[model samples]
Target: MKAFWTLSASGELWQHLAISSWRALVGFAIGGSIGLILGLISGLSRWGERLLDTSIQMLRNVPHLALIPLVILWFGIDETAKIFLVSLGTLFPIYINTWHGDTQY
Candidate 1:
């Protein structure tokens, strides 16, 4: 307990937290932007729905973890891999919710 509290007060812990928070924010922003754009396109226009909706739905059904091996192979063990993984994981929920919101009204 003492060690943990000391570490939490240390600069290293703060730095690690800052880096993680930044990564999460960036990943979410990228995922949300893509999802919002796609949802808007599909929900607002007939042509866009025809062109993008089926594909989006299909991709949404895919488990994000299933892509981990490919992502690791392609991106290696880098920060980009972490961000990309997070973005991919977040994309489907945002996309689905945005699509539902846009279409419901």
Candidate 2:
């Protein structure tokens, strides 16, 4: 607790917090945009739903942790990978919820 106070007083805590918050914000924006677009398509069009629903459902079933290695391999251990992983984690919930809300009669 004392160490936390020390870091906070020195602004290190704020810096780290800001970075994390920024990452989450960026990830959420990216994920939410894609989710919204896809959800609208799936909800509105029977052909679009047939095209996208299966793939999105499969993605929703896969755990984010299980994709860490693949994300790393594909994007390398950089900010991009971190953002992508965060986006992946954020994507499905928004997608699922939007789909449900938009599609259900």
Candidate 3:
């Protein structure tokens, strides 16, 4: 497309792409770190599982879209909010997988 080519040639597209990549990477790191930590804790220890698994499972059941309004209210439509949403979106899956992997071994 001519428009796409124009934007790419101007560097605007790359800039936006880089920003998006950064956000995704940062969010994934934060979410993955927390998820892995919590998963390990829960998977390895009875007390940790008792304390966190039920709450995490319950929270996981709620839809991400349903939390958008609340997230906007809490975070106020900023980069932080965007990253938080991404991290929150990523957390449960990473946690569930990590926990399962840890427990299965």
Distance from true location, Cα of 58 in model 2, Å: 0.7
Error of 3 at 42 (Å): 0.4
Give the lowest summed-lDDT range of ten residues in model 1. Answer: 3-12
Could you give candidate 1's per-residue lDDT for residues 32-100 as a string of tens digits? 889888888888888998999999888888887898898899999989999998888787788888878
Model 3 lDDT per residue over 3-39, tens place: 7999899989998889999999999999988999999
Between 1 and 3, whose lDDT is larger? 3
- What is candidate 3's CA lDDT for residue 68? 94
C-alpha displacement of 3 in model 3, angstroms? 3.8
| Model 2 CA deviation exceeding 4 Å by range | none
What overall lDDT goes with each candidate model? Answer: 0.86, 0.87, 0.93
lDDT head-to-head 1 vs 2, winner? 2
TM-score of 2: 0.91
Per-residue error for 27 in candidate 2, Å, reads: 0.2
Pick out the ten consecutive residues of candidate 2 with the lowest summed lDDT. Answer: 86-95
Candidate 1 has an lDDT of 0.86
Q: Clashing residue pairs in candidate 1, if any?
A: none
Error of 2 at 49 (Å): 0.5
What TM-score would candidate 3 get against the native?
A: 0.94
